[model samples]
Target: MFCFHRLGLRAAAALIVGLGIATSARAEFPDRPIQFVSPYAAGGANDFLTRLMAQHMGDELKTTIVVDNRAGANGVVGASFVAKAQPDGYTVLMGNSATHGTNPTLYPDVTYDPVKDFAPIGMVGSVPIVLAVNAKLNVRTVAELIAYGKANPSKLSYGSSGIGGTGHLAGEAFNAAAGLDMVHVPYKGDAPAAADAMGGQVSMAFVGVASAASMLQSGKIRILAVASPKRSSSLPDVPTLEEAGFKGLYFAQWYALFTRAGTPAATIEKLNGALKLALARSDVKKAMASQGADAAYTTPAALNTFYRSEVKRFGEIIHRLNIKATN
Candidate 1:
């Protein structure tokens, strides 16, 4: 195992003491306005979740929680901002697996070290993506879709959120495991990708729950299979990809809270509390449920462990796929 030098240990202790001082310095954590940054478009799923959590967190922290949209470079822009921000408690990042886990493998020159540069605050929850078919496809289950793809081969195409986003990786992972080659059609975002699927421009898509939930409910698109280990609570009737024949083929994207690596420990603890409480609220749970999202919570340590595993897993996949990072 690797070990830290003497000076490094002292620095860690000072950081902890500093956090304690910061806590005592203020009556509470949110004595000032808090800024939460989302590394995606203003209206995407990441932005939506950050907004929802901020509203509830505002109530608990007894201060305004401002959400800033810094969309670009597949969430790299906002994440880089957060990585370089002051280690103080005021600035926080809602980091997804795309930036934290997969980017390292995809980008040959990763800007931020996922496990080193940021402190793991807490996990928001998990979102299971679905393999959805347009109403025109006439394919409804995973079995039928596989058979049709095999017969037609490259004739069928599917859309993804972006080239290296979690939604995109899910589709690629499916294709790799199933040994089938379907033309991959990339889009700017999940909304547009879902739009193409609904418009019959694409035969099917592997998209996040947020973009496809309403369409699925209204019968706009037929869900072939949910890419999760278990059936989603919101769509329990929909079989998992494993149940549909591709056993152990599960892909879900989740978000975690973070701050610069040198952030105050007390502030981190305070933020973790707020996250747990916000996720517990009936309103957040209901909102997530409507979006086919589950309200799961985890402690800071657990979140860190999870983050490490995800980083390792996605690192392997991205390297194999030869995805090159832009920045």
Candidate 2:
């Protein structure tokens, strides 16, 4: 009986040791390097924000976060890749308005549901869209641009980063509001669209402020109005579409962090905490401002709600405008 009692105690001790090891393994989330996916090319605003957040969040998480650029299909390729990634919190997506707000509706065969396939981590920031015309056009204000478009329908065309991006939607909303017939030209990215706008290839380009910032300095591109509720701090002198006589029209190129759905709630919380820490840093905010983005953060739940609403709102706009993806 004494020997049996000792054996039973040893068995219990072994079980306790095994359980403790399992618990430790579970707690060591992100023991390996995490992959941060940017769904755009390098040197762009999206990539810049991705690297910036990765640097700060990685420090807070005590791990190396590698940025992987998977640019294609107006953010479809990278978004789909992250959507299908393992739900282990190691693979995260720097998704934006195109990925979460409009792509699902634009691409008929989009592989993932924005709301269902991803767990919201938090919001990063937003860059306001702007209506910028070539300086050669001599258009100085939104009203003048609209009048010119109406007077010369053949001469009025607008370029956007892609077919279904916020820039495209903003341009279309402007067309509907001002009764203009500007042709829509879709570029592979914002730089090309803004470049063409400055080069006189298009009458105007509906692009993010960052894409047009340097060109504005060169005196080649003139921003007519911001496609947001208020003037962006980066362009304080510009007025919003509402203030320009087009009320209730607002658009911004927003970005956020998301991981594949079904990731453990604790892991999501850890990522959110690190993201909040990164966004709170003054350097991060200043860097974002320089890129024409306002540094912002939201709780995971709040982001989830905002994301859903964006999806719905963009869907209505796409449907109304009859916007379709060319490829």
Candidate 3:
């Protein structure tokens, strides 16, 4: 009888200890506020999303969350910083396609592995790319742009945000799919490239929907076609590239949340839960939609699959087009 009593006591103690461990893990998961890093310029689409997401995430997590813009080096410096950070679920990188999928193939020594260095939390959103041309150029439709490019050959120059940007890849996809010979011009960023395109410095450019929304509305630039899988609700009148006969040329600025690798699974899941809830808010949905951004909060496993597929997708395109950074 004493042995059984002792066994019962030991079991109860083990149960109590397990409960304490679980409670401690949950408590330490986020002992303090969190920081979300935006590796893009302030006022940019990605930066705006980061700030808004931070606010909403803070509300969800019941902790202060802030955005720190570390905009430079095509998101490499900031991404590298996050990659080397402690996997403590405190510092998260609001990374985009540039730093995650496209840079690995574009920059040989980018200082971090896109797949291995970080643990995926969730995919935030993606900004669709649109083919916009100077309003006065008299090119309003995709057919007209294709015709003009074919007839003028190297005379029609297309600008991109930068080398290896989604806009750049969109332009290359256009040329590949339509067999057009347009001169490719690389710009410093989306705003500058769209500026030149609006000013008629270039005949056309693959512009991010957010970057070109104002110009398109003001008649500064005419959108030829959208490169997204579906027509943007903000620009429902515009047709998709595939609908315009340029199939297999989809491109967009995909954004996702990630933390340094080796973060505890519970910690990662906690962050993901907060983000998921935050992104589902109506205001968050509306803000993202206004910028032509999709409110897609993908699971870590789903994000990993999508990231790998995009890497492969762009890799094939790069290899086929001989796209090398000629610095």
Candidate 4:
């Protein structure tokens, strides 16, 4: 009995030591530089926001984060790269509504499964899209714009950063809900899209508040409605689509972070904790506000649920409107 008791004690000690080593390994995670992938080109809103988040998140993690831009196919290139990378905590994706929510539904050949291949970390923020027309247009309100589009049919044209983007879907939703026949004009990015709208190359475009702020201030465009459920703090005077009499017409581009799906749960917890801390920083919030982005954070579980629902909602809109990706 004495020998047996000693043997049991030794085995228990070994097990405890093993567990301690495992815990230590997790605690020491991210000892090296982390690779943050943004699947879009540099200088766009997505890239800018991703870089900003990475800076603060890196500071919290006490490690360097290198942003790798792999632009192509509307975020598919970077997303696929991260999806196939080792399921370690070092490789992550800065994905948005397009990469995770709409691109999968819009592209029949999408390589990565947004939910199946990635473990959501948390949401960074959301930019409310605004519907604005060239000041040259005679319409003054959302109702008037709809009436004009209905009366003019193809005579009304709207530009978007790209097809199957939040802006594109918002335009299509408007067309269906208000019984309008506005044509969609796709541009390389929001800058060109807004520029064309101001130049009268298109009647209007659904653009993010940050990208459209200059034109809104310069009186080059007249914002008819914001695509958020409520008025944005950035545009205090602007009303939501619901407030504009189009209840249930809502759209916003949300940005979130993710890692390969098989990353250890403990690592995810650590990353999520760091993310919450970074988002809570006042400077981060101010920087986001400057870009018309609200610093909205969510737990990993909450983000997963929200991501799934957004995928479904965006997919339904794509099908309902028969929207297609032009590029």
Winning candidate number (TM-score)? 2
Better of 2 and 4 by TM-score: 2
Cα lDDT tens digits for candidate 1, 1-327: 135677788899999999999878866566799999999888666887899988988887888999999987777888889888888878888998887877777765667887788988899877898888888768877777778889988888889887877777788788878778877888987778888898889888898876776787667688778888898886778899888778766677788788889887898898889899999999899987766678778888898898899888877777786554441
Rank list by TM-score? 2, 4, 3, 1
Model 4, CA-based lDDT: 0.89
* Most lDDT-accurate candidate: 2
Displacement of the residue 29 alpha carbon in candidate 4, Å: 1.5
- lDDT of candidate 1 at residue 67, scale 0 to 100: 96
Model 1: clashing residue pairs?
107-325
What is each predicted model's overall lDDT from 0 to 1? Answer: 0.82, 0.92, 0.87, 0.89
Candidate 1 regions exceeding 4 Å error are: 1-28, 217-220, 324-327
Q: Which digits, one per residue and each the tens of the lDDT, describe model 4 over residues 188-261?
A: 88778988888899999888887777777777788888999889999889889998888888888889999999
Could you tell me the lDDT of residue 32 within candidate 4?
A: 92
lDDT of 1: 0.82
List where candidate 3 sits over 4 angstroms from the true fold: 1-26
lDDT tens readout by residue for model 2, 1-327: 999999999999999999999998877677999999999999888999999999999999999999999998878899999999999999999999999999889987998899889999999999999999999988788878777778887678999988898999999988988888889999977889999999999988999998888688889999988988888999999889889898878899999999999999999999999999999999999999988999879999999999999999999999999998873
- lDDT by residue for model 3 over 1-327, one digit each (tens)? 999999999999999999999998778667798989999878888888899889998888888987888887799988998999999989999998888878888888889998889999999998899888988778778888778777776788889988888999899878877878888999987888888999999988887887787776677888878998789877899899989876677899989999999999989898899989988899899988877798899888898899878877887777788888774
Runs in model 2 lying further than 4 Å from the true structure: 1-9
Tell me the lDDT of model 1 at 141. Answer: 74
Clashes of 3: 0
Task: Report lDDT (Cα) of residue 166, candidate 3.
Answer: 92
TM-scores for candidates 1 onward, in order: 0.87, 0.94, 0.89, 0.91
User: Cα deviation in Å at residue 272, candidate 2?
Assistant: 1.0
